[model samples]
Target chain A: MSAKMSAATYPLSGPAKVEINEVAPRDGLQIEPFIVPTEGKVAFVNALARCGFARIEATSFTSARAIPALADAEAVMHQVERVAGVGLTVLVPNLRGLERALSCRPDEVNLVMSSSETHNRANLRMTREQSQAQLLAMIAEAGKAGVPVNVSLSTVFGCPFEGDVSEAEVMRLAKAFADAGAAGITLCDTTGMAYPNQVAALCETFQRALPKTGLTIHLHNTRGMGLANAIAAWQTGVTRFDAAAGGLGGCPYAPGASGNVSTEELVHMFASMGVDTGVELGALLDVVAGVSDLVQRDVSSQLLRAGPRLRTHQPPAWMEEFFAKA
Target chain B: MSAKMSAATYPLSGPAKVEINEVAPRDGLQIEPFIVPTEGKVAFVNALARCGFARIEATSFTSARAIPALADAEAVMHQVERVAGVGLTVLVPNLRGLERALSCRPDEVNLVMSSSETHNRANLRMTREQSQAQLLAMIAEAGKAGVPVNVSLSTVFGCPFEGDVSEAEVMRLAKAFADAGAAGITLCDTTGMAYPNQVAALCETFQRALPKTGLTIHLHNTRGMGLANAIAAWQTGVTRFDAAAGGLGGCPYAPGASGNVSTEELVHMFASMGVDTGVELGALLDVVAGVSDLVQRDVSSQLLRAGPRLRTHQPPAWMEEFFAKA
Candidate 1:
């Protein structure tokens, strides 16, 4: 018998402490067609906040004409009560958006800058370098204003126009964010083009290049690898993650790109592995259901529909009994 | 900086030789509602044989009335062009099934015994011990007939009636199968109850107890852990896997448990990790489409819907014109 197989508990040679950032209210609601009512957004945020998520992306302060779904960002933010330990965050596109977000006084402001030049122009109407500099200036401004900044390095995974993104380019953007006093950096697989090998390699490189900055991963399951990429990032010691309730959010520009990583699914994956993410499974499901209701569409979360994998218990009937009995 | 983060490639510190057992002909077809023509089965098996699969579960020698899906097993086996290195296998239910399988002269025979006592009684009208003894007898008979035998421990993950299964009970069944001279043991998530943690724990236990015995995993994505469980098993040195092309096969008892782990998705997962499993991606997709035609339903495989995530080359129209002119 192999000596490694003799151990009772499979010891993974990696760090613990995984943190999931709920992006449903922001990323999820942004793409939905029918506007989720301000009250529904508040209820959704509050419900997810109770799930022990340390950070939740609450809303996006963008042009009302652009992302009409989240136009009532301030009203939603005002109505939702933040949990004690949870950080309520809102996305800010520029200094004006950041100023509007500061009025809501969210715990953190997420500033997004596309890594690809074409994506930057499409998403923000700025060059990649100009957007990076703008993001850095915003981070400096946020730091002075006592708001932690999480810079989302979008299109780092791949871009719609630019087929293959270089590792050096991603590292360069990550270093820029790190040097700008950004509280954390998130690599958004905006186009869902990352393979596991690429994710592992780039995450390792990013971690080494910016050791002090906290790294978060935002993945899309468009190609059915959201969970796999999350595992790869987890193996590389990335703690923070961006996921949507019921796997919401798809890129409008990227054809066939699907939803973000399902939050219920992510929680289920980590909690089953004996890693503590401090999220309640049942509560998270309630949030998924609420969000699904708010959006008026079938959310693409397998766990939400199929239920958790329990070794013993007949589901459907058993689930009704379990919940009723509870 | 963490030492693990600086390296380009972390050497996966366990077993590397991956064994993929193609069960498309048997497990893939057995659950289909439509009857696949005998020649179609033969052609499918021959195509899979050329894919360098180490073991191919070809047919199940059972009463046509019991499983009408595999009624033409004998004719399919008689027509398939046997490859030199691949092991052609069939499933045997009882002594009569074993007799029929031996007549076809398969390279190996697989006997399925459920760990759930209720499932054991439901699947085979005998008690757990009686089934074990009958399997032992079949193993003895197969050894005399000069054919190898493999055992699939079904419902090892969970049972509908029994809700949760214990690691100890599964290990006991594996020991019995190994002691009976079965060439290998397959852990089946019959009801999709095996999560990745349980998979890791059981695989580590199986590898330790049966060092020389082959270990294979047959998973259904009923609860969405199919891919995650595969990765967990891979990390624990489990190489052999069973997947259906286009994610076909489901249990009649477990309603909504329709998809198996898609062969194309598994191929993508392994290939992306730089693990070579000699199935050609393009050819596999073609076979999936062919089988989908034979079965008359779109089997759920995302990669079949979305092509491989290779880098796209999007040259500017002017650049393209310039190159075209040149």
Candidate 2:
């Protein structure tokens, strides 16, 4: 091996605390038709917390009629024992949802606004400008209530309804979110339509546009470009990323979309290349297996299926002998 | 967008020639049970030749009893017309096969040696050393007959029995092949167990060892790291690659060994990244579709399923009008 190959080790440097915001509880479970028991939800949250994730999206505070999946959000929240240093965040669509989230006493509140007008109207029955206004008010209210807030901009790439999204549009919306007292901005490719070039270009532009605010790119591997895009984003200097454990998460509204980028796969790729991702692969797989059993269906993650790359185990002598004899 | 965004342009470079050695007629059809008509094989070869492939593995000259799939090897040789400047190669496992390939007047002859003892013994009924000796003898014979020879070292990553193959062992075998007057060495990940790090490390080591010899990394996406490994190999300065159109080729003897790296997908990835991989995506997909129809199975090439990234179409006027109305 050359000196270069031996020197493959990335020191974890950016943040002492690697905040893995668990979206599976909200983003993953919300899409499944099977309503998991409140106990299951509580157990799942506890399990994620045990995996060293500091921030967990405990549940969404949306209307029961709107998202039936999160109907028992309040009850589930009440049952779970909160871990120290772990902040629970909940998605709040409007003032009513924000009020509900506040009642749960979440550490952080996430307010989302769709960049595309068509999606905003289809999703919330409100125009994009109206949704932004609602988000601004929610941010102001959350600030006064002493709750940290993060805003997720959905369909920042090409939207299903509007088709191609311009860089100018994404920047304008990102600027609006940053101005609304939001602690961070999460760029979401809701339909999994963003290409690697688009991702790199956008990340570079956003980093320059908002240098002080943390930028997290939440990717959907619906088109198998998630990891490629992630690499491109990383190349463009974006640090924070939102990845679902075992590749578990998708938009219910986006038809044919599969899963988010697998956390195991992501960490495996980075770690193999000597990049520090602050994730333990073996421990992560244990969590994936636990959740996969609860879900019943086979998960879409390949790393879970194939195990980590270059990972091997020595078989017992008898097993080796048997194969050798054959 | 700044100059940084300009770097995101697809096919990031001008048209650079990639040596596309079409393996369809040989490695592609050799594992099938059903007989693909001679006319069909000829047509496939003719189509692939026009698709800007610099090299084509036309057929194998092995015994019909061992591989019934390539029974029409001589017929394909006579029927298919080669493109000017496109080198045609054939696989020859033994001296008899070499004699048969020589009769076909192939531009180059490929001698394959499985690095795994168990596979070499089972497949060729010979030990690894014995197979290597036979391959060396065949190379000598081909040289005497004025035929250029390329050596493919299979099972270089891992073996079914050995589990893990060390870099030293792979290098030893690669050095032996180069010493035997082989034109180039193809380092194959026969089991699809190699990751990008391994690929980079191994390719760099091999290149350092044999600075004069051309190196080709043939990969399989059995575990979803094929493209990543290929990219890693390319970045490490190993330019030549072997990909099956629609990823059609694999060893029939190896279980769970999936398809080769898809030609369409590889071409698309390179083109999208602004790297010049001379093979045209549309033409390659056409070959993939032809092979898919001939084989009667859905091949697992993602590019063929999901059209190239940034694929666009004109919207209907009525739809636009309706959207304006809405």
Q: Output the number of the DockQ-best candidate.
A: 1
| Candidate 1 residue pairs in clash (backbone atoms < 3 Å) | A311-B163, A311-B164, A312-B163, A312-B164, A313-B163
Please give each candidate's TM-score. 0.90, 0.82
Minimum summed lDDT over a 10-residue window in model 2 chain B is located at B1-10
Tens-digit per-residue lDDT, B1-326, candidate 2:
01122233432111233455777678878886667888888888889888888788888898989888788889999888968977888988899888888998999998898777666665566678888889889989988999888999887877654676878877888888789888888988876776666676788788788988878778876666676667556545667888888778877666556778777767776666665666777877777777767876766655655565455333333544554575
> Candidate 2 docking category?
acceptable
Candidate 2 overall lDDT versus native: 0.74
Candidate 1 chain A: worst-modelled 10 consecutive residues by lDDT: A1-10
User: iRMS of every model, one decimal?
Assistant: 4.2, 5.7
Tens digits of per-residue lDDT, candidate 2, A1-326, equal 01122234211112212235668888888877777788888988888777666577888988898889889988988888888877788889999989888888888898887887766655566668888889999999999999989899888876666677888988887888788778888899886777666676788788788887778888876555676666556655666777778778777654445677767676676665655555667887788887766676776556666566555433233443554575
lDDT: worst 10-residue window of model 2 chain A: A9-18
> Tens digits of per-residue lDDT for model 1 on B22-99?
777888799888888898888888887777777788989989998998988889888999899888989999999999
Best by lDDT: 1
lDDT of 1 by residue, A87-174 (tens): 9989999888998899998999999988887776666666677787788888988998999898898888788677667888888888
How does each model score on lDDT? 0.79, 0.74
lDDT of 2 at A203: 83
Q: Tell me the lDDT of candidate 1.
A: 0.79
